[model samples]
Target: MGQLDGLKTVVTGAGGGIGAAIAVAYAEAGAAVTVVDINGAAAEAVAETCRGHGAAADAIQADCGDLAAIDAMLEQAASAMGGIDVIVNNAGVTRHAFILDLTEADWDRMFRVNAKGVFFCMQGAAKRMKAQGSGRIINIASVAGRGYQSSSNAAYAGTKGAVLAMTYLAAHQLGRFNINVNAICPGVTYTEIVSNLLRDRAAERGVTIEQMKQEAEKSIPIRRGNDPEDVAAMAVFLASPGARNITGQGFNVDGGLINS
Candidate 1:
């Protein structure tokens, strides 16, 4: 039997990149996964991949930033999967700009999706888990939350900080209910999101994508960038029975990017 045999999981932002990787990982571990994303087609594609791995998976399309939408999605997920044992709040967005150049809209949008969406989704999922008497809620944060001075917009960083704070509060409040809440802070991962950013940077610097990737890898003490599977492996471990004693902790999966 797989590590997650018989577990029902819901993974947000599973349409692509890290989210898609997480969904597949959970499925491979024997969990029935609900792939939720803003993009219906992409979500379905991931679900299909999971199904191909001999796991039961379903896809749902909803704007995670909307409380009502999230509520509906959770309800559907619960109904489809019988009940949700784990929730991976991996949906997020980033807007890169200097503090002075960032608009109020950009700030709000980042908070809405990265912070607000996570808050309500966790709230909804926690409620169900509380009733079930057990659950795992893993929020995806970033090294930006630990205070990065290299680059990235202020808004994106702020939202990640909020995610870590929320994870702590949720873990404390839900511990008594047998619900485990935690946050995973990844450093530089080679996802489509980061790939696009590197591409843009390469263009701006009149360099090739390969050159930009090398520069990014040099910044990490590990001498290489993280793959989506790296983060997914951590998520699987956290959601497994072995991590029952672990909660309210913010794990840094950034290849020694932040020593703390």
Candidate 2:
């Protein structure tokens, strides 16, 4: 039997990148999944892929940045899957700008999705999971959350930092109800988001993307960039019985980029 047989799962931003990978992995593990994304067509495409794996999958078009949309999506997801067991808050966005160049809009948009969206999603999912008395909440944070890092602006990092904070607080409050809340911080994962960032960083550094990548690889102990599957594997473990004892923790999936 698959590790997560019969579990109900909700994954936000499942249209592409790390979110899509998580949805597919959850399905392969035998969980029914709700793929939520602001892009209706992309969400449907991912759902179809999940169905191909023999897991019940539904696509919900919703903006994770909107509370009303999130609530609606969760309600529909629970109804479609029977009950909610796992929630992966994997939707995020980033902007490249210096402190002086960062606009008010930049900061507002970053927080709206990365921090505010996460908090509401966590709150909504926690309520359902608490009622059920068992659930797993896995958030997709970033290595930038730990502290200042290159290639990202101050505002972007601040939002992830907020996510890390929320993960711990939610874990503490939900643990008594047998709900496990944790955050996975990824380092240099080659997602669409990273691709966009790389373009900007490459121009700034006057180097090719490959040169920038090779330079980054040297700093990482594993000497490799992350694949979407790498992050997906961790999500699978968190949803499995193996991670039952783990909660309120931020696990880095960055190839030892950050020792702490």
Best by lDDT: 1
**Model 1, residue 145: C-alpha shift (Å):** 0.8
- lDDT (Cα atoms) of all candidates against the true structure: 0.93, 0.92
Q: TM-score of the candidate numbered 2?
A: 0.98
Give me the overall lDDT of model 1. Answer: 0.93
lDDT tens digits, residue span 1-260, model 2: 99999999999999999999999999999999999999999999999999999999999999999999999999999988878999999999887788789998898888988899999999999899989989999999999998736748888988988999999999998999999999999998998988887888899999998888888889889999899999999999999999999999999999999877
Candidate 1 has its poorest 10 consecutive residues by lDDT at: 146-155
Model 1: which residue pairs collide? none
Candidate 1 C-alpha lDDT tens digits along 1-260: 99999999999999998899999999999999999999999999999999999999999999999999999999999999998899999999884566898998998898999999999999999999999999999999999888876446788999999999999999999999999999999888888878778887788789999998888778788887789999999999999999999999999998787876
Q: What are the root-mean-square deviations of the candidates from the true structure over C-alphas?
A: 0.9, 1.0
What C-alpha lDDT, on a 0 to 100 scale, does residue 171 get in candidate 1? 96
